[model samples]
Target: MKKHIVNLWAFIHLVAHRFATDGVAQTAASLTYTTLLAIVPLITISLTIFSAFPAFQTVSTNLKIFLLENMLPESAGKVISVYMFQFSENAGKLTAIGTVILAITAFLLMQTIEHALNGIWHVRRARPWTQRLLIYWAVLTLGPVLIGGSLYVTSYFTSLTLGLGHEVHGATLYGLKFTPILLTVTAMSLLYLMVPNRYVMARHAWLGGLVAGVCFELMKTLFSNYVSHLPSYTMVYGAFAILPLFLLWIYLSWMVLLLGAVITAMLPQYAQGAMAGEQRVGYQFDLAVRTLVQLSHAHLRGEVLSLVQLVKLTHIHGEMLEQVLISLQDGHWVLRTNQGWALARHPDKILLRELFERLVFDAHHAQLDLGVIVRQPDLNLSDWVRSSAQLKLGEPCR
Candidate 1:
């Protein structure tokens, strides 16, 4: 029980740190504006695609209703949905160049989402432009079809259940209550799983998605409760009141979404004893030791360990693992292949002292260890570390 609490607290601390460092709120605000700008173009594209498929026309209609009802504040949702439909219709009739421009705006929104997710995951490299374009384009084109299809399927079955006009009311009620939340969870999970150009455990992504979906549903309920009191906003801003209210809702939605992303990104890094080094010196060194030990074992088996595998073995997050890899890479102690990361040289060739010497810790950089002065006042940290181990970290890679 105590162990769980400590891990939970540590996880919370790391999340707060990542939230501040990653500028999650700022990123969400940025997304809100980008979303505002690109929403019409996105709608235009989705609507155009649906038009091309006669079978999906009804499903597409249902999709719009779902979005307005679930994602927006009730009073403002009605106004926004009406204006959005009009904007989408106008956008659909544009010339070829205008259509291309609309597509570009929609792509811009995709780019923004990718950037935010990649940052959360600490992914230094992005997928190639061709690959990214194809993937994002696929998502934009197929996403509505998938989502709308699910909604259609659910409603169709529910209608069948209701058509019986029998006593299956409880099951139908539960279904109606849970379907939107389930859909939200599924969609958010896909975003968390795919947006970042890195490996993510499915379980972690699902947990994050679950949280975001439930919170989003609750947010919608909260919005409805206070929507009746929007008379003041109406009195102050008149007809334009919907605009700010809409933006605020978008901002809050992003906040919830990004918090879920943070949770997903942070889970791999959180372990029962992972954060113990935070209060101790050489946290980086400890991470390095754990990583190198794993890589060394993999080397013995003539295997390359992927980032996902390393995280499991060492109980470290990819973000921290990347740092340790870089340090080892700098010293020619580790190698990264197209497949995964491995040891570049013999493990014993790596000296513990040299590894410690080369690595730096941020929080402990200024704190000198003077505990030795009480006994051997002449014994310095450098010599103590130097003579402690004979492992050849200082040796050249084979």
Candidate 2:
């Protein structure tokens, strides 16, 4: 239990570091701007899909109302919903070319979200354009249907239970209190699972989603209270106060979502407390050696490694591992393949001296005598990088 607690704390620290360094806030701000630009078009697309099916028309309206009320400050929700409805309604009258433009605008939002999530997952490749087109359109078309259907089913049952009059009112009240949280958790878990290019374990997604969802609820409550109690904003912007508050909520929403992605990506290492020591005493040399050792083994097995594979095996932070890979590439010892990364030269041909010089030797180490170190007979200055289990980068076949 004590170890688990320590691991949990370490994980939290690492998650915070990754979130801050990954420019999550900047991504959120950028997404906020894109969302503001794309909101009307996105709403228009959903409304258009609903228009095709008369039964879903009311589902569309209900979904919008539920989202605005549960996800935004009450004052901001009312004003912004009114404005969005008006804009979406106007969007319905666009010409054919205008409709294509609206769809592209929505695509831009999807692209931004995928890019941000992929960064969290350390994914270096994106889905092919054909695959992206299919996935993006499916999301644009079917996502609302799923959310609306779930909401409809729950509300239907609640309203049905109300046939007993006030007898079930308390149960219904409790249901109302919990529904938003459940929905938030489900939505977040799905986002974490599906947005990243790599595969995500269900448990990690659930854990991440649970934390982010709870935080979202807590933050929403506090933000709403602040906006309500503090009249300063209203006194200043007056009717326009809704704009800034709405934008602020959007930014906060993106942050929570992105933080969840970061947690999900790093959860495996966190599970073992592998990331507890964020910094190492000799990170550069140690990382370089470990990387070379791993690549050497994989080469003998006729396998190459993807970035995700390297992160999994090394238990090193993705960004740091990437930097080490870049250094090795510069030394012409590693190659990036279409399949992944591989050893550019046989491990037996590489020298430990090269690694030491590149990683350990520094301008600050001018006091160390190069000739004296080279003159040591037993040191075997030309030792193979993976020469032996002792040296570990390699040795001769014999």
Candidate 3:
């Protein structure tokens, strides 16, 4: 029953921590409402410009369909469609004004999009002004141009593939399917090159970005399929179902972004550490020894005690003890002796016992050591250490 309660409490705390860390969800909701307010004017400005270019007729329609189908909420789409019709009627006179308006609109849109994507990717760095300017510029101008180019490529490829649909067998279809894969790889490469604060190893960035992209694509498909399946929340919270859905999705998206960050940060270091480990055996033993010194009250002696006895008394492993003694010897804390181990400098025998006792007392489990330390939180291993050094120098140990 106690274990059950502890588990329940831990789960509650974990949930609280997650909500506390969720900057992305909070920022996304803020941007979503702001973008909603700007949606109609933004759509009208785009429609006006596209109407002037006959070559972009199909591109514009496809863009409109894509945005309406994928990006906007149902209510927001209706508003955009209404504004688009009105803009279509006045396209001739609106051209020059629309161009200026479009620039302003694109700036707003890119700012929001960049903020949203950065939030999604959990990018925490203060982006330099030069880089930020370049990113905004690319997203504002090159973004639409890229979308146009991608549509053109996809259309051409579809035409080619459809013509030879029957002639393309399993292997041929698989080979031709490289178009989307190539496009994905190219986009992933660009994101790695552009989005990071510092330089990322190309191989690590490629894999991490590909994973993010794949996860994003899967989420998009899953969201589209199940978005309407959110039951009438009357049974759960009635009219408030959308609130939970939105909040939950935002949380899920943030988790995905954090996962990408972890993958990118840890993978390369992990590979390097593994290779380094092969060349350095017994590193753990050395680390354990260092930790022992850090944990102890006074330097160990070589003549009075060997590492074997230290390990036996402390319940630390033999290898770990050897490492600790070797480190101490290297530091000139102890000297070789005919008798097992002894301090390099002769200290008062009684003083050595007291310091050794204190060290042993500290190395116990925390719960057991708490009683002695609680009354003297200011006192540390250093007090005993300095006392032992003083005894060696013939100073009184009071």
Q: Give the TM-scores of the predictions, in the order they appear.
A: 0.82, 0.78, 0.46
Residue 29 accuracy (lDDT) in model 3: 61
Using TM-score as the measure, the top candidate is 1
Candidate with the greatest lDDT versus the true structure = 1
Better of 1 and 2 by TM-score: 1
Q: Candidate 1's error at 11, in angstroms?
A: 3.0
lDDT of 1 by residue, 1-398 (tens): 99788778878888889989999999999999999989999888888877778777777678788888876778889889999989999987899999999899999999999999999898977888998998799779878777777777777887787788865568777887788788889888988997788778899999999989989988888877777854678888988888888999999999999989998988876643555665577788888999999899989999999887987898777777787898889888898897889988898788776676667422233233323333354787787566544535544322
Quantify all predictions' global Cα lDDT against the true fold: 0.82, 0.81, 0.51
Q: Write the per-residue lDDT of candidate 2 for residues 13-115, one digit (tens) a residue.
A: 8889999888999999999999999999988988888778766767777778787878777878888888898999998998999999999999999999999
Candidate 1 worst ten-residue window by lDDT:
361-370
User: Which residue pairs show collisions in model 1?
Assistant: 349-392, 349-393, 350-391, 350-392, 350-393, 351-391, 351-392, 351-393
Ordered from best to worst TM-score, the candidate numbers read 1, 2, 3
**Superposed model 2: Cα runs more than 4 Å off:** 1-19, 51-57, 118-135, 164-176, 197-201, 265-269, 272-278, 281-303, 310-317, 351-366, 370-398
Candidate 1, residue 221: CA error in Å?
A: 1.6
